[model samples]
Target: MANALRTFDADVGSAPMDMLSALFEARGWQCDVHSTEEISGKVKGSWATYQLRCIWRREDNVLQLLCLPDIRVSPEKRAPATDLLALVNEQMWLGHFELWSDGGMLLFRHAAMLGDEGLLSLTQAQALVETAIEECDRFYPAFQFVLWSDKSPKDALTSAMVDAAGEA
Candidate 1:
């Protein structure tokens, strides 16, 4: 069968890292942090570039931290932009909390129903993408977390961009 199409986007700032770390730690999620130049790759002529990613995962859910620097900001501007960092911090805190709550609810509802193999299937994958989109949308207006959910891995990558943009 052909692969299903996917899409999503979100940009948030930096303050949520510690909160996320704490929350996930309490839940026993394994957290891994890495630094890289870029997190996404483009197709032959695509304009989109991938963002750096920090991933937190447990048995059920995955939380991502994305670092995106402003394309408009040049290397010549060496000093960190305080305004950008503050914006990112606000959005990440709100967005991550919303995602956490929604993911928890979905996992609670579907855990037994999905089981192990079912949870690993395309249907479950789609549900996860959808849940993230829905939760993020519900919380976006309140916290200014801007993102697009296209139901693609690209969307997930974009989320990291939102996260990274905060720190950048």
Candidate 2:
């Protein structure tokens, strides 16, 4: 069978970011991936806008994805953001959202191990992007509530779960 004899020439290829860049661009995201170390782009979701970044870690042969929301958790909101993020993180499968300490930037972070596991396929790469963006989009309103309102973390999370029984 043709499949049985096919060989993967891992040596001839570049880093995983190359394929990821192409994939991101093809999906209508204007991606900047010319640098050997990292790629950055923007993605617009129905619920929120996110800044996207993919970085190559040479030491670990891993590609990491970061999706950062434009909102910052104010010092006053940090407590609620922490509680909300913890609940949301428990619900995530791939990456978890984090609130950075210094600037309180809320970010979605996920990583893929490359070399030892073989190259990251385009499908796999896109899946990572989908997971990150979906989580960001899914939980965006929770953060917004925590940042701008007087809602508790649990209440904020509950508010984002809009009910749509028959609609898709």
Candidate 3:
């Protein structure tokens, strides 16, 4: 990997979002949290959504992370960001997963899949999230977790692959 894709030893913390945001900002990167509702018009339907987005410029290319709460995947009518909190309900089955680009970045998403009654234990839910994060780090040295949103930039993967291949 090129120096441009250098890895940072992220400090483990209770607040994942705050920790991530601070880590990136310390490196001169910018992070933003955008709601699906805010960018809904840009997509198609008026679905309510929320996301945490991070952006950084690597020379001419831009890197980004758009983190979305789990409810964004539900087939419910449009609701506010608060509705996403229900995704954390005790009866849900939680799991975490990460999707990484060949270049060297990752998109991490965790969900507490709702069931008929209660939520999964915190330990169980967290285990899934931990697994996903670990997998992403193992696969991509410069991974950035993001939400699935229309406003999220799309070129990071392609650019990273090109850069990686060029180094070879």
C-alpha lDDT of residue 44 in model 1: 15
Residue-level lDDT of model 3, residues 36-155, one tens digit each, is 111110111112222334332333222233343222222222221113223222212433323232322223444333233222333332354344434333323111211233211223
Best by lDDT: 2
Best TM-score among the predictions, by candidate number: 2
lDDT of each: 0.30, 0.77, 0.30
Q: Show the lowest summed lDDT stretch of 10 residues, model 3.
A: 36-45
lDDT of 2 by residue, 5-103 (tens): 123232444457776676676677878875877899999986767889988887888888999978787887888889999988887888888988889
Q: TM-score order of candidates, best first?
A: 2, 1, 3
* Structural similarity to truth (TM-score) of each candidate: 0.25, 0.85, 0.24
* Stretches of candidate 3 exceeding 4 Å from the true structure: 1-106, 110-112, 142-168
Model 3: what TM-score?
Answer: 0.24
What's every prediction's RMSD, in angstroms? 16.7, 5.3, 17.2
Clashing pairs in 3: 36-49, 66-146, 66-147, 67-147, 90-118, 90-119, 91-118, 91-119, 92-119
Give lDDT: candidate 3, residue 69.
Answer: 26
